[model samples]
Target: MTDEHPQVAALLARSHRLGADPRNTNYAGGNTSAKAAVPDPVTGDDVELMWVKGSGGDLGTLTTGGLAALRVDRLRALRARYPGVEREDEMVEAFDHCLHGRGWLPGGEGTAPSIDTAMHGLLDAAHVDHLHPDSGIALACAADGERLTAECFGDTVAWVPWRRPGFQLGLDIAAVKDANPRAIGCVLGGHGITAWGDTAEECERNSLHIIRTAEAFLAERGKAEPFGPVRPGYEPLHEDARRERAAALAPVLRGLASTDHPQVGHFTDTEPVLDFLARTEHPRLAALGTSCPDHFLRTKVRPLVLDLPPDTPYGETVARLRELHEAYRADYRAYYERHAGPGSPAMRGADPAVVLVPGVGMFSYGRAKQTARVAGEFYLNAVNVMRGAEAVSSYAPIEEPEKFRIEYWELEEAKLRRMPAPKPLATRVALVTGGGSGIGRAIAHRLAAEGACVVVADRDAESAATVAGELGGPDTAVPVTVDVTSEEQVDAALRESVLAFGGVDLVVNNAGISLSKPLLETTAEDWDRQHSIMARGSFLTSRAAARVLTAQGMGGDIVYIASKNGVVAGPDNIAYGAAKADQSHQVRLLAAELGAHGIRVNGINPDGVVRGSGIFAGGWGAQRAAVYGVEEEKLGEFYAGRTLLKREVLPEHVANAVFALTGGDLTHTTGAHLPVDAGVAAAFLR
Candidate 1:
């Protein structure tokens, strides 16, 4: 964090690690832009909006693709949209529409907007944050809301009532703007706070400092904040206390966890109660979250507080709680009776909140319990501020129940709907091996035509440079003289490629050597040579590409130029077929590993893309004439008659297939061997 503002792109990725584990590992909550992408206010771009942490996403796992972009105007309009949406029936429709509607995603050029987009937009500050800090929420609930905010934040921050955090929240902010006019920043007592800076760096600096200060406050206030013997890993949340609850909750929690891989376990150290209690099976968090304004809608606010003392019977505790839980239910009915009307904030689900087992500690369960705690933490922090502010004056939210009705209603689910965004390949760098004169060159040209910076990697510098020169220069297409099999050359090519451009997104491992000789006719040297380029070389390039792609997390695609022979036997093609088959096999295994990291690996098998390839001009001319007993000139037409399409295949066709496989519409596809041949193998077999 610094005073110097960051670039429009800099905020997309940073080393900002604040949400470290209780032991030592550092995990982030989300990414933000405290520094504006646009430099000048008057002349600055209107594209500015505080891109904040999404409701669901791990900061450690965050990728450029995950950042949601919201425009300033679109955010302002959200305030206006909810006022008119009154009924849950009508409100839900609008909410879904808002989700479908392009609200403004800066980096999310083509992505589903975060569900909390409205919450972040409502903050008047230049940048806004919402994170689940284990330590932060521990303070949000210090008995008194406003006092805690002050105890931790002092007088610089303002405190607002927690009023279901979306459209209603924005309306509240706008109203506050209408009244106080100069209020710098405020926190939703049961949610989080918003702080602004004139610049992105200033914003991040302020946010980080504020968080650290809050941590310091907790240390001083808790009277138990000693680091002496307790560190993140060393000071484990009592595992024995949570054993049964953890065991019982595991099966039921998968729905809430969502991902195939959900972090579960009770180790000696860490946020023990939080780790287990957050995934409580009961609907307490959900009810709190869904009925009124709380983390219920997103995470459901019911916490399964399980700190059972050694003597208390588990059966008796559950029975008594069930019978007396009517207080929470009564509060809901009364709340609904008092404020709800056809147009007022409506309830969507049932839940229990504020669970307090004698030993387990306090918890607020919601759809995502971790999220619930974060919201509660934000609220608890502001509660302190409110207590201080209220001491001088009364504290209320930027009240607008009608707006809250829309944000918490069923309609908002539309914003959560997603069908993957467009690929980064839309406008970025693409490297294709053997691109000088074959399918590689064809793919390079096709990608360039599709608005990408293309790198044509080949052994022949003359042809590579010539092809590159014809297409354009470094900006469009550039030829790279690389011996793909050499690790030094591969690394050099990758480094030079990134240096030439800011980064690389697509790697087309389309280089290969083909020897069209029978198995007995193929020499060991020929086989080794073919495998070197077709298999080992491709892997080397892919390894380098994976490092870059994984770091960016937006993803990159690797397209291997294998042959249809890779999939099926091709007569008199022993060396080529063997090498290509190895390439195809590796593509499948690597896809699973790379996909989770945001990179994609797939292949294209073009049986005979000789039209615009080097093979057409060189090796094949002598061979085809001898094999067919016809002049070389007739070979192209003779080959055309032998396939399903019965039309000769072009290099561009194969290249187009590569582009599609790497692009978005087919985001779910991987481990695919798309055949670009005119069905020649099928024709020959039949």
Candidate 2:
């Protein structure tokens, strides 16, 4: 926790507080800086430097390495070279060249500075804070924003018209600071707020004071009328019908957003989303640009609107929605062509991130679930800000030209380009039963590495949590305790997965017990114990998963981890073999039933995988070794030598085979059983 400089440490603490509060800044949205003196690497003279939050790092979880330092004089002097430049590339290049000692200042070595560093350096203060507070943005986006600023703070705060952040913005801010020596802050019309002071505490205080002032002004106006009730012709549908309608529409939207290569995820609206979309003016207001420029980076400039009715036939509704989506993309392309000037980069994807359906509500789409949720949150916030602005005065956002500049800015585009390529299962959700250890644990880890959000479910609650923590903590892995034998617990697990990650796309049924006993020696309890988890658990989990997968309308996979003994039973192991055989047969039957709904049900029969398996831990390995007339220590080698591959099967080997069954290559193949027993000739199916 030690920092290279005291000022950097102070700034880091303050930035964390601001970032943790969603009202102050959403994910990775704001920037903060501190001015200090550092020794010059070559000249040995003291040079003034500004340490600002670097790009692509969240302020709430920022570290010393997240801030980049640049020479103040070098950044300020670049203005002369770009006197009338409209493009931001030249200015951004100059800023990079000014980095202290051709690297970072101290702790920051490989990070790039924020694009707003130039403006932050030009301000006349030791500490500066910039935030997109909801209250301030409400006023900033209002028609009479400048007039309201004058009335709220009088001359204590300066007001600057909307301008894309670059060389010109830095110059304008400096002039305003010089004209009003006593001013503590400035409000950027149709953008955000900036506050500075000699100390970090003073700067934070000024920011809070400005936000409270704006809030008081809006409160004085009283509550605004709720958006007029849904248009008269559009009646609200019953709750059951609404859910059914959303289910029917999700697949169409998913298909429209997908490309030829096809990587897309989606989430339907919640209660609050439905309420907002039910408003009569929702179509017009939602089509307008974002409340501020930063939001465009998440939600795009505008959301697509559709007039889908609940009673429409499914096939016709899908056809009409597809046509509308094409039109929306065409409109987006025209907007880009209209604004592209010389040297503008080629346009990116034209698909809208947010979509509004009159009867079903809004849906947000992204390459992953986390990203879709982020876009959804921004849209919700935009609704609140628009409502507040309209309450005080007409909502007047910045012109479209400014939005284009921000959206296509090279710095912003670079952030996306830097991310690594996604894996095949990236953003998909999977639930693995008995994932605390053995084959189940290996499968969970593999799926996570392939970019899926995993839910580790086990009857042993502690073990489930331990495995989940190892994968990626709570953000990427969730832990749920469920004895899959119980129908209620199985249903609850499905609901939990949906709550955690919007929906489930994959389910691994791998929980069971092994019992080897002679027919005469086998008690009724032994038979029930084996069958309860193997046959009954598989059925319960499969039924619940099918319900959710059908509701999502997106294709899914269900894999059952059976045993080689099921194919060829061994002496005195009738109970275990019988249960596994039941599960294997059920896979084919379920596959036949659910195939029409796009659900693929398959099974994997793996034998002699005793290296890290729970079956071995339960003493089954010792018992089998005794039966084979070998010592416990020689069991692994004995099994390896028996297999065609002459190698002991590991959990990872089984996991790889499971991935092959589900990862697109076998999309058309269902009700098929794959053997993962190192080429067991006896277990091979004809």
Candidate 3:
């Protein structure tokens, strides 16, 4: 719905425009506000109100309800109650209680106002915009940030030193504004920029204009000299070798960072990441805190740097990388304990959100693909800012204490704490063979909905891509065309999974073919086709996945989709049943062998999941109908009536069983069979 107030609408429009660009804002890092008069709820009098972007909401897609309205007088009056940084929690509580009207939208309520509501209230202008533009942050984070501000904007901009965002920082900004009444904006040292004017257009224009000026200044400096040379003992790997190394190392890094409930969603390598890692001073420079306080919520204070060369053997490097990851976590814990004061919230998991390998590139970690991509974007921007600062002057970010304050700030923590409980399979990766159709396709969709990044592997390339597109595209599901019987294709598919996501946590060995005939009539070709794709294919994929999962040291699940015919002998089903029976036995042996490595092997024996499946599309349904003396369309009814439950077993039913086995509930149980066959007495597992 369109906002009733034109000023509020205009401010929302401007916020979206600025936030739409990642260079301007990264993953809800910036906020905007507009001051206007609205009718008081109880008293029929006009009251001055400030509409600020609600905390934790993305500005790019913000709506009227996403902007919280607060009483300006009450927020300003809170200054007396919160005198210093010690009472920041109390100050934020007071800000929350000062909401205007019913405190939220009619249907949508409970969103907290931006933590900078007080700052926006203190400003005298009608409109305000605060953003973390890369160019501006570059200048603001330099050692001589204040002098650079003066040189760029002259008297039009005020400078505020680095301070954690709270009542005190707002007061400091107010003091700067009072001293320089003619200034249109302020450059926040080691933070960001804030622009204000009488209208939203003026505020946006001033913000962009200041950013442009800083860009021009940095461009001129860039022409003078290069920043530095490649660091000692670190040389860029050849292009092809680098990519191969990245694919090999991705699973190792992902496994090291993963917990029992892991969230290493994906790994990305780009030219910027490579260039940043190739610098001589990257080890020292990257250890400094983020360019702005807002980034602390996305990427931690710094990234973990690995000294191993790109040419290191994957087998030898896995154990060493795991050791480094452990050390990194230990250091993170020490850093937190040193800075954490009394009454502070308990520290969170110390796993690094970003990892840097000198000869390769950098990797960003998150629970999902979008978040990983967002963290990568922030690091890229940081690279640019650091380069610019080094060229002009020297990199000087916020102090460690300040970084800790922002990192554990209640406002920042609230963003994570307020989110709904994650799905059972959230942050886990699943590879489903034959996912283009049949039972495999249903399993892929089901796992993705429960929050796993799915790899849709099928022999039909177009079909696999189509299924992936339907399940939310590449960000959530990736398509891989693989004839699983071919060892090379199977190996490549596993590598692609590691490259697309970080590693594989679950493997669904659901790729199989149906070839049915009496023993006397069964042909050699039919026997080979069924056994090669079902038995041999499962072996290759399972072995590859087991190796990666063992190297990771994190437990994983392998689920095979067997058939009820394997348990109960069916007429004219020799080749299909024998191959499935072989797969079922393999599961038992695999579970016994790989259980030491924390890999669980299980199977699902499903009957008559013919609807919307490749079994039906490939004419297996018609063949089965002929055997039962029923028409093709009546086959579903025939199967449903024969079962004890009188319910047709569906692909979804099979998927649900897969979810139960791999979704952590069966952590201790393996070499087991889950039946989804509508209670077939003959097919029941003993």
Candidate 4:
């Protein structure tokens, strides 16, 4: 086995963290891939199924499961068929085909392999791997190409000029393999490196070696300065036009270039980085090409930066692009004919071209669904470089002529990259109420453990402070002391959280009040208080959070912690049950109002939360234990064991239920009550 095998998981995680960022979409995004032992259904022997990166997985929490697997031969055939498939959705089904019987994808139905799936599939040696190494690319994109290549790869690898992806890239790689025979891997100029070995461990070793070498090289050259601080003035355009144009061009770009990027047609709103790239001095990014040519394989040769300045004519714009297209097509046709042989069906048709428009930035064009993670890291390096480059002289990427040549060159491009699909909640944030202890605390910890910034709020200042301190160590957590039942305090706390951490993305109504009594013994005051805490508290919190979240244009999550007794119609706690029933219905009403705003509201009813501190001890006390006729210590087991799971319901378990709702993962589920009880049939689904 190759040395890279053992460290496969670790390397994948490292690569992910180093590359996670949404901003890098403009540049080459990073990719996560693994070559693991998968038993072939036909032979029942371990056939190598390379799992490539899935879309939307930020690097910090990438895992083998996040990578999509494609049968290699089938992947290569698809690349041969489509010349530029980078930004197209039609190509998605090809990736999905491989997952028909595979259960690893989210929803466990069928899913597409990542756009980078092609690159991983194309590696033919013992094992193949790739990533957008920021430091490595910095050296690779430097002025002296040969020197940088030598410094990083140390003559062990070959260098390929950039080219559009698909058949062209795969064809180029095949030719290279024929020539080098024993090449470990090669560096796609201006792109990341491809490292291979007999096993994942060996591949990781080589990858690390290459990365370290490149880092050392950059250190010697005095690291980079900042890049494109272009002030992207907003220019509005038709959203439908952008989407239609983006979808149309995705496939062509993919076929033209061998990038493992997904098809990002267009984004309604542009981030600062996207805006800047779209408006930089050189409006024609692809004609001049990416920081290097290899990016064309992913991002297409050029992007259609939307809505240019008024001075640029709409008619003149189309004319200019037509000319550019003619030139690019002529060159690509010539190259394809030269490399794939005369009349080979693979080289028959479709030459890729770039589109550019003013103002909108390049989003109007086909998108490179890359690992933003990789590009983000590279941008950081470029920031240091661009700053220095600015001080020295105007920063020039590759020459326009060289860029075009590289963008079309068959001998330079890497293999077709197929990308994995994105997950529903990759970068979502969550906040839970009453996190000082019990279910709230457990839920807060659970969310944080899953790679989210969990905000723990509670009425108890000390407990809230302690839980917040545990999650972020004073600075990360914002502990607020406020009673949810009090409108003024609740409003103030919500305002403080928004000011502190932008806005609350997820809110859990884990804090509630319950009072037990015979119907005759229940006072109007007692009923009012319990109703205020459970019903009023939920409505107040949900209403406040929804306003801010809707204004931000990004939806949010809300979960109310209710009780099974509310659904089961239990005796001795009419007020508590009625209050919960009110809370439950509130979820339905809030969900209806909030859905339009992209906000979700739901509830989880727990039968026996064994660890609650305040009321359960004072009110129900041994009465709850009496239901099961068990002693204090065994009381929890008795209540917890009543469920089908035959286990006690811990605060941690209840917290998990809150975590799920607040995650906004089950988009189909809202206005519903999910039970955390072992297996009680208490919920009356509506």
For residue 101, model 1's alpha carbon misses the true position, in angstroms, by 17
| lDDT string, candidate 4, 1-686, tens digits | 21233435554655554455322222335564655555566777765555566653544456655556566656656765563534333455566665524443333422246445555666665455565565555544555544556655665766766644334454465566557765666666555566667665676666667766665655565524233444354343455444333333322332232222222222222443334444354343233444643354433334433334523554554445556545666775665555453422344233332333434323222222122222323333343333323323333355545544444433222222333333433334455667787778887778766545556778899998888888765224568887888898877676555433334567888777666677898999989998888788888877776755664445667888888876887767788889988888888888888888777788888876756644566546566555445676677777766677788777878767776666546877778788878877555453
Query: What digit string (tens of lDDT, one per residue) describes model 2 on residues 456-544?
Result: 99999999999999998765788999999999999878767765665678999999888767899889999999999999999999998
Go through the candidates in order and give the clash count of each. 57, 0, 1, 75
The TM-score obtained by model 1 is 0.40
C-alpha RMSD values across all candidates? 14.9, 4.0, 2.3, 13.2
Index of the highest-lDDT prediction: 3
lDDT string, candidate 1, 563-678, tens digits? 77776775777888889889988888889789887777888878666566687577865575566676777777776777777888888889889878975678878877788878
TM-scores for all predictions: 0.40, 0.86, 0.95, 0.46
Local distance difference test values of all predictions, in order: 0.54, 0.80, 0.82, 0.56
lDDT of 3 by residue, 1-686 (tens): 12257777787799899988776766677789998887776787988888898777788998876778788888888877876777775687787778875443444443677677777887777888888888888888999989988988899999998877777777888888889988988988888888888888899998888888888888886634334676665676876777678777887787666653376645556766777777767777887857587676777888878766666777666667778788888888998999898856778778888888867777788878777767777887888788778878898988888788888877767777888998888888899999999889999999999989999999999989998998998879999999999999998898888878888889999998886577998999999999999999999999989867876677899999998887999988999999999999999999999999888999999987778779776888888888889998989899999999999988889999999998878788999988888889999788
How many pairs of residues in model 1 come into backbone collision? 57
Displacement of residue 380 (Cα, Å) in model 2 is 2.4
Q: Tell me the lDDT of candidate 3.
A: 0.82
Best-performing candidate as measured by TM-score? 3
What ranking emerges by TM-score with the best candidate at the front?
A: 3, 2, 4, 1
Model 1 regions more than 4 Å off:
1-143, 153-156, 166-184, 194-408, 416-513, 517-521, 528-572, 577-605, 611-675, 679-682
Q: Which stretches of candidate 2 lie over 4 Å from their true place?
A: 1-3, 102-108, 226-275, 304-347, 355-362, 459-462, 481-492, 523-532, 539-556, 585-602, 618-638, 644-646, 660-674, 679-681
lDDT of 3 at 667: 80
